[model samples]
Target: MHTPIEGFSKLTKAEKIDWLSENCTTDAEKTKQLLKRYWNANSSVQKIHDEFIENTVSNYYLPFAIAPNFLINNALYAIPMAIEESSVVAAASKAAKFWLDKGGFKTTVLGTEKVGQVHFMYTGNKKKLLQFFETIKASFFEDTKAITQNMKKRGGGIKDLELRDKTDKLANYYQLHCTFETLDAMGANFINSCLEQFSKTLQKEADVYFDFSADEKQLEVVMSILSNYVPNCIVKAEVSCKIKELDEDELSGQKFAEKMLQAIDIAKAETYRAVTHNKGIMNGIDAVVLATGNDFRAVEAGIHAYASKTGEYSSLTHAEIKDGVFRFWIEIPLALGTVGGLTSLHPLVKLSLEILQKPNAEELMQIVAVAGLAQNFAALRSLVTTGIQKGHMKMHLLNMLNQLGATEQEKQQLVAHFKDNAVTNASVKEALEKIQTH
Candidate 1:
């Protein structure tokens, strides 16, 4: 048992590590040294990271990798990925290369609208509330002009506003349903700032409106925040070629396409298959989103919701064989930023944006959707031909070797051994033990 320390956040980095090591770790010195080992050597760079979050200890690192040969809309790109999972980048790269000559990928931005709401409960008469909302709606926009000015200049801001009544769903509940075009910025701050101001303006004006009864004027303003489920902020990416173009080493093009289509059909019909199918797509989307300093969690939430928009969860990617043309595509909701948040702050993020030639939010949206589609294609291709584990385990072999503390020579030998043999945790361990005993 350990006593809790007060003002843990106020402690110095060294002190925090010391306390954590003493209380939480068996070997305090080892834990302290290990945590400090990940710290940036440059003070300036380290300081930037420290301020990124509270109770800072040390940096957590992930490989910032690239999947090149992606040809989208006639332009070539090498998309950056930041993830820990093995073979995700390799799978994406393989897909990119495979599609390089098949017209690569075609992408389109479907929408750029983001959503937010000011939720409240008013037991007042519905007629009076509706009347009051109509009169006060313009004031909401007027009050948020200062916040929306810069966004408007960029041809993006306050696309729509409406009064929504949800009394039928939840008693006396009402809301200000609002939408905005945030352009290259994810605009959470802008949307929230506007919604908050709308809340203030609504309450103030309601207090002064002449038609309202005493209770009607007592408008309760609930929390105002941006909605993560931005179905309107979506992008579509597609790839297509003749059926003959899908030929793999193990399967003919026709057989591979049929098997892949069958797998996708199951994903569409079954919840379990759909969830895992979408997770693989996220492996690619999230990697690029993280590398570009965008919010992957929001992107993920919105996309999963969109998947169930038809009343049942289903596949994000769609496919068909039309007139001997084999096509696959995905339309996903992705609210992303290229100029704000960590994009301008994190060094690797800035470098990543430059590597992709600095795409705007819409452009970034397309690129991310393509990454997801490419990943799904790679995974389905493998599943239809060689199976997912063979390649995945091969890519994961290095981590397994490291876990066993195998020397360079041992790793080399084992890797060659696994080339003709199946790689598994148990198999690798057995092979390593045999090499050691010999």
Candidate 2:
């Protein structure tokens, strides 16, 4: 039997939660924890203090919304995201709806484990340093073995190792890159700790005129710091459908795909265009990263770094029309989490998770990657056809009227007037007074 879908605004909070739980394999306990984190028994002094620091005074709060009509891996899901940008949620929902109307988004994730990089600098011969690290590679693995002992017991570990040497811009300094897998957790702390512990042994074993520091607090021996950039590693997914419904020209998915690919190519060619191009991608990725309490800043850094890894800034996603079907594919560094930190602590975050039904790490990554691809298409479609500012300015006009203290009716009238007269504060004021008196 076919069931009617309810509009998001029509569903109550509890109904929404119930719908999510019924559709996905949500952890009830985690759902409860999320509610408690966002909703308090009493507005206590401590609660106010925490809110002040984490929210209002500190500007930590972010709005979250559920992108509707996602069908991933043959299952229906209302993907949850935390973001501030307009049109992103709407565009994702629209793209997903279009796919759902055809069939649905098909997705696959590599694994649950995430990798973190540890870098070392050398002033000695690059080839010799590489050979030395290779010689003691097993020992280095053993030293960091305890860090992931539990994960190893569960059959996971440092999956690979990579080393790269490049001359600094000044030509006097040498940069050495060491890449290692941290299994799960953001692993920043663990990766840095392992590098610090290994540096002492590395310096003594190899005759390298180098000093390194990962002491967290000190910056003495540090040339540059942090292991936030993730390279080469990719998380990917695709959505495709037959073009049976729409005519070849009116709303052909194939044409849409071609236009999208062209926009991405143009974005790659210019630095200015690449900024907005990447921003559109981040609009989707960062939301999920924040909702899950993953370090979104790190994810952003890694994404941009990976984008430019080929020496040219480019779109992380690609779309096409192949074999009479519309297809979209994306492979980007999505370092996100399902557990730990404020994910378990924050109240609204908990609510957002409940609304999402708490997908596991791999499932979550797949959904986020899909959302990113959808958002990319949305932006490209707008840029290629209607112009980005048209829809955006329309939405902004409503917000502007509301901010001006216009009543609901007055705001509606103001929007109508602004559409004809152009959106300006002076025009808004004139419309406001005309609507107020008449």
Candidate 3:
């Protein structure tokens, strides 16, 4: 192993590449070439990408694709998705087309509140500490006026603030629990700045208060941060149609509806099934989140935490056939932004937002939730009827063909041959060998 180099971030890009290739790679020239191959040819664009993160090597690329025919809330949109997976965009598109004739998707914005907290420890009497908190409650807002000014002007700012006692959970633990409205911005930096200022105010005021002994004055500030578990920032999307309308040439409408409902029930009852079920939904959600330049990891964390909010990990989508109607819906927590982060920096992100017709945060939330619901419907539909591998493997065929070094002509032939045949590694290989031998 090579010794860790200090000041690695201080190194120039070319120098950084040199050092990494010399120390970390087997074929240094090949490594360097491959890394530079993915770099943007334009200098300014490359510079922007280099500064996006530390230790810039090369730009990693995912296929940027569009899934068309989404009709959301009486408006139509063609969603942009950046992903490498084979069937995700296709599946979402198919679901969208199926529901397009069934009145499309209806969405509701349930809430838009986000949370933050300032934690501190106080080894003093609870009664006097709470009294001191009451005296200084106004100061928290007063001190954050500068930070909140622009946000307030935009109809978004601190919603509420309160003191929380956590002595039972941990000795001397207390928090300034807070909520905010961030509008079109994700508001991580905004919430964090407010919480930190609140902590500063807490310390400054505690030093001057004359309510108690020296022990009470020495309040230890632990940390200040925003919570990713944004249960309050929620959106719901659903599609419904007459139960008789689910009929396909292969499966009857009532049987199809019954199987779809049973699949949802299994996902709810079994944790193993629920995890995979939710993953399928995220396959659609993360693609759009990434395309629109939002924090997929944070979205993922909050959604999963929400899934387990009932203390058992369960399905994110629900279905029912009642009164001769088949309805499938999903409610998920998504904290997204349209004007901040990579929205302005990444060129593709700008195009994605424009493609979505420049949705505000709430509208983006609705679009994202609808994508997830569509993906789940497509997956469940496949599971109950034709089985997953038939379609998944069909989409997967191209990757296998390329991996086997098949030419474009051979690819076309094999694709046609597999049209009425099953797809597997061995089957594709056998088909290719037969073609080669002939």
Stretches of model 3 off by over 4 angstroms after superposition: 210-218
Candidate 2 lDDT, tens digit per residue, 22-122? Answer: 55436755654564466444666336434433222112346778888888877888877888776778888877886786667677765444444444444
Global Cα RMSD, each model: 1.4, 13.0, 1.4
Worst lDDT window (10 residues) for model 2?
A: 215-224
lDDT of each: 0.92, 0.65, 0.94
Give each model a TM-score.
0.97, 0.74, 0.97
lDDT of 1 by residue, 319-393 (tens): 998898898999988999998899999999999999999989899999999999999999998888889999999
Compared with the true structure, what per-residue lDDT tens digits does model 3 show for residues 1-438? Answer: 788899998998889999999999888899999999999999899998988888998999999999999999999999999889989999999999999999999999999999999999888778888999999999999999999999999999999998899989998899999999999999999999999999999988987874556444558789999999999999999999998899977699999999999999999999999999999999999999999999999999999999999999999999999999999999999999998899999999999999999999999999999999999999999999999999999999999999999999999999999999999999999999999889
Clashing pairs in 2: 37-347, 38-347
Overlapping backbone residue pairs in candidate 2 total 2
- Model 3: residue 390 alpha-carbon error in angstroms: 0.6
Q: For candidate 1, what's the RMSD?
A: 1.4
